[model samples]
Target: MEQTTKNLVLASIGNIYEQSKSSSLNAGFFESADADLKLVSEYFGVTPNQALIVAMVFALNYKGDTVDIKDLTEFFECNPLKMLEYSDDFETLFNLGIFKKIKSTHRMKLSLANDQFIINQKITEAILLNRAMPVVEKERINDIIELIEELYKLGKQVDDKEMESFELFRHVSSMLDTNAHFPLVKKINEFEFTTTDTYLLLYLIWRTVNGNEATEVGRIAQGIFSSSSARINFVQDIINGDNRLISENLMEVVEAEFFDDTEVKLTANALTLIHEHGIKLFGKKKKSKDLIEPESITVKNLIFNEFEQKQLDFLYSTLSDENFIATQERLEKKGLPKGITVLLHGLPGTGKTETVFQLAKTTGRSILKVDISRSKSMWFGESEKIIKRIFTNYTEYTKNCDRTPILLFNEADAIISKRRDAGTSNTSQTENAMQNIILEELENFKGIFIATTNLSKNLDTAFERRFLFKIEFNKPSLAIKSQIWHDKLPILLQEECDQLASRYDFSGGQIDNIVRKAEIHEIIHGIGVNFDNLLEFCNTELLAKKHESNLGFSKK
Candidate 1:
């Protein structure tokens, strides 16, 4: 804003702009413009050559066209080949965030001619206002999760090829070095890790915090090591547990069958160390494949008969965020269990699971769906441990989340079925053990838990007492079914929908199948949907609708 600063900047730009028309910017060219070069360097804190490059870029057409070295031939009075020599300076300025990299031609290495650049707007503003370079200090991050989030963002930049891999390592290392207010830094400093080990540890922590357990190890090693042989050797060391990251108990491998598919994550000890520093970055993610986000649930405009709808309305009210929190608080005051275990029992395809999803969606909660097959293992005692971990993980999710998620055991016939005598067989013992773990978890559970089962009649007596809400999903009435058909496929006429509803004893799931089939028919055959097409699709929908069984042998 000062006149003196404006005069100095104008003088420097005039000097550089005049020199740019030279026949050539020879070896001693910057030396000749000593006063201008020195002033530019002092203002921007860049090298003389970098300052000259920036000044030249600033003097370009104000429209701010993305210019490559080839495009500067006319202004510099030099050939495109000659301008290529300044690629390193251009690249350096671009990396410093003074120049914006507009795009890349290909994934492979490209010439300076192929690369495009434009002056970063902030840099242009500062220069135009005749102000010194802006020094934006990185905020001192005291939270461990915040630090990991920052690293994760930068790591993504590297993954997207927006940044150099080495820059990510340098930026993170420098950030922690400068902002040493947090205990994480102190703990990391205590490790006394070498640069490579430090980078590996940080990368694993970021990946773990981001719930990216399957990040390729080679891609990370490639980022840490420039030399091809060194990268390969270090990756081998990582996979073989020879690297300091693995040997020091800072990281562990994510089990994968192939070497190329190998990945790594923070070890339990490493997670504990992170926790000791006042923030826990690693917890069970509530938004994953098995854990469904409420928005993604497709059970919209769900229709149920009067009795079922009333039961569902009550359940939804109880699970509503504000209501649930208030109920939990009052229950806690009375020294009662704050958990609400819900039993959604009904016939298959009768909207039991769909109702659960709808409840979660309406209540703005996530569903941590249980995979029963995976819960049971062939190995003795592992089944119980798996069940315990599922509950344990859910507990962590509830603590970290704003609204506690619903732990949904969809189609949970195996879980709700009566347990056999433990003395009969090892399988019986395992079943009893899993049931016992569930009973105990329910006793201590402090969040929303819902399990949908078709075989409610076989319910274990103990779990029956634990359920606070039991909502049965019976087959829809004819009127409700007709409404559901019209709602699901708005293209269907009310009379047609009513006729179809009157004809077939279909559940909501079966109707969904028909809608999907009609869509597919229209797409594949370019046929306009008709009632006959709907009827045909409906007729074929039942391949003798059999009850889904959860009986399968363990993989060898």
Candidate 2:
């Protein structure tokens, strides 16, 4: 006759639990059972004692009750201290996923006895069907985020001293090796960071995507390192930039000058890497007036000179969604930054900002406009954080859009100009710090960035190297200005448009000012002013003269 699970349990845990007051469940008792220790141990591929504990938990789960080592004292009628002997086997079973660990309401400072265990539901079903349990079991990692989060939990255990650093690191390497199917896992494995460094990187990745806002240096050290000296050394390594995560551009320690505080976070490189796996780090997207949708932008006809037009024509073709993605992929393959950074540097009224608007409109993308004024804060270090966040938020916003948007720094002279000498003054230092971070972010930037700056002369050389397309917005040529005038005021005769364009070397933007004044005139007087009135509007548009009163007339 075949031995069923019911008979098996009867021969094992049930026999012991029923009418048996054995103070000691020793080798003699197990050997005397109908299904003895040796028979069960070899069958289950566990030690004799593990077989006994498994049978006990199986029977407990069948009854909808939990089992713990603490409960062993009463169940087996053995001494409570003797019950402690099963902890190693219990944990092994829990780790194997054969037994599920459940939270117990034990008081603090209690030992492993406080950990209650339940048989894995699947394992119990298999047992009921007379099927054998697998020798080893673990949760399968479905994606990079799950793998990172699992390692992160093990890292916290290292802090509790529940596990050693090397063991935690071992699990890190093992988890990565086992889950190398993930894109992020494959990328990280391509590099040879030490196991400890890999774990640290994973911890930061976990924090960033998990939205755990507290990344203070001290707090991180306390959570990741077990001993005081190790914590201090880890903190020092971060501060000194000696840590692999810092040196390799996977993580960063943001410093606050006013309060002398520090917080750690995943760097742009790390953010980009994780994003390649399609995980958008939460809470990084900023919702403010700064984001301009393409649909919201007014269609403006821009007139540039021959040279500027050529540059813009090439840029427009390269930034079309298909061309942009193909180029970025090729650049990434070559280990070059996959960013299409454009520096539109020229005079203030040269249509730099308007060009960005047109580019975004033509490319079918949004514009994350950087408001230069609000980007800086009176409080120290806040500006730098805001700058870093701009990049982070842009990274998140990429996932929210069908095509990545443009990060426009209109009138960016304030941010991209020649950085001041370090430590010159608080404001100067702040400026220098902001520029340095921008340069760094530009290093691995992965999207379209267009900075329109009027400071043609003082723009930093470092910034020059970072920008791929440095197109100058020279003031509109005489012919282009004439065309702009003809387009803006079709009411003007061609000769009159030429005369207006030739007399004043106005840019498209300056021409726009005159067009607005002409609009006001028509609004009040209900008729187009003569050519003299057009010149008058142009003249006062640049001067401080009270130009709105003449109402409909440009000038007499």
Candidate 3:
């Protein structure tokens, strides 16, 4: 908390007090102070003035006196000019309450009474503290302090007072300590506890406990903490804080909830935890089934034309072949190759990413998309580390599941583009290192890898030969586009689909976008599908494509 925050807190309290009086209701001074303190402590550290101002405002407003700048200045033993200098600090407080600015009168006065102020204070305090019990469990406070300590250990610099406050709260109460120390343990005992609370406690434990060993706890915590509602019911049963939750129960739960069969015996929870913490109680279990399977990526609603389907089928078959495996084995016997790069060159919006995704889906692999632009670094060797990390993750996943994960290098032209004289040495070096790492990883890789680039000619010839396959994804033919439009759009729009498809040389992705835009337009304007709206949408996409082409050319 800075002086500015303190002034704001005080101003907020004062405004709340005045508002309470006008409505003949009580304001929450304690609650307001606690909230202000928590926010300020979290963001700007602890400032005594902020704390002091809060205390003063509470005290003055509690006495039913109209809070003015002069009164606040006197209470703080500060000059009026000093208060005026920091007047802007109170604007947030003023907005939160119903404090009106008397621009014509030039005076600030409270329109409410004292009793209302006290009531408001009590309510606010109750809401802020979350309960009336002042003495929180000592262990809870310790746990919070310990959590802060862990964050500090991880190089997070937090305010000393913030840590101290949590410590103090924990010291005063037993239940709080019990709740904080072993959140998962105690949360299990709470009869009314929900999965959200269970996950939250797990998160708290992970945040508090810092170590490589604690990663399993973190992953288990994260699995239970996602926004996806579907996961809750699935992960519900084996969550008890008993021995059953650890071994047999977890295995059973995994089979029953996550996977259809027991052959793999690995649940999403188990996989997530194992990946993070590295198999804690159990010895590393070999994956019987592919962890990164094609079916894992939901594509049931995705519509594609025959041409797009053929391209996807070709890529999928190439990756899935026994020949590829034999080749990798032969390479390994001879000693691993430097890199195995597969390039998917095509026009923009021609399903490069979708094809990559489809391959990942079919091959049972996770696609770690490489953002080449962001990966480029000015600092020597830094970009290499980022690239290495991506490959390292892929390697680890492959090793864990006994299947190599797919690495999707999107926008590869940015990295693999032919060297230009204008680019900095740093840029060239970074690109070379990225290419080198790709080469190194692929040479020994038993898994599938794909890179999508719009500009095939921009890539180095040496790099091109490293790829096991180079697939060219061409724009959909007019007939293919017509079929895509007919299949994707509503049944009522069938007659118009052929005319629309003939009008624009759209790719599969572009056709999808056109339909999506039409749907949005229908929803917004409350109109049926019309030629004018469809044409406008097509024109919009064409303009966007032109703009991107111009930008790409300009960059070159």
Instruction: Supply every candidate's count of residue pairs whose N, Cα or C atoms clash at under 3 angstroms.
Output: 0, 2, 34
**Candidate 1: residue 254 Cα off by (Å):** 7.8
Candidate 2 C-alpha RMSD relative to the actual structure: 8.4
Local distance difference test, each candidate: 0.76, 0.76, 0.51
Q: For residues 1-556, could you state the per-residue lDDT of candidate 1 as single tens digits?
A: 5658867876897788787675477656656787898888778788887887777777773545666675578777676677767778987786677777554444333345445677777766776687767753223576766776677666666556655555656667766776567777788888788766776777777776666644688888665554578668987887777877678876766555578887776655676676677756635553568878877877577888888888888888998888998999999999999999899898888888777888888888888899887788776676886787678667656666778888988777886689998799987888888988889989888888889888889998988889999988888889999998999888878898899889899989889899888888889999878888887788777545532332466456
Q: What residue runs in model 3 are displaced by over 4 Å at the alpha carbon?
A: 1-296, 300-311, 318-341, 421-425, 490-495, 525-528, 543-556
Candidate ranking (TM-score, best to worst): 2, 1, 3
- Superposed Cα deviation of residue 556, candidate 2 (Å): 32
Model 2 TM-score is 0.62
**TM-score on alpha carbons, each prediction:** 0.56, 0.62, 0.45
- Predicted model with the maximum TM-score: 2
Q: Write the per-residue lDDT of candidate 2 for residues 235-276, one digit (tens) a residue.
A: 778776788787878777776452226677887777778777
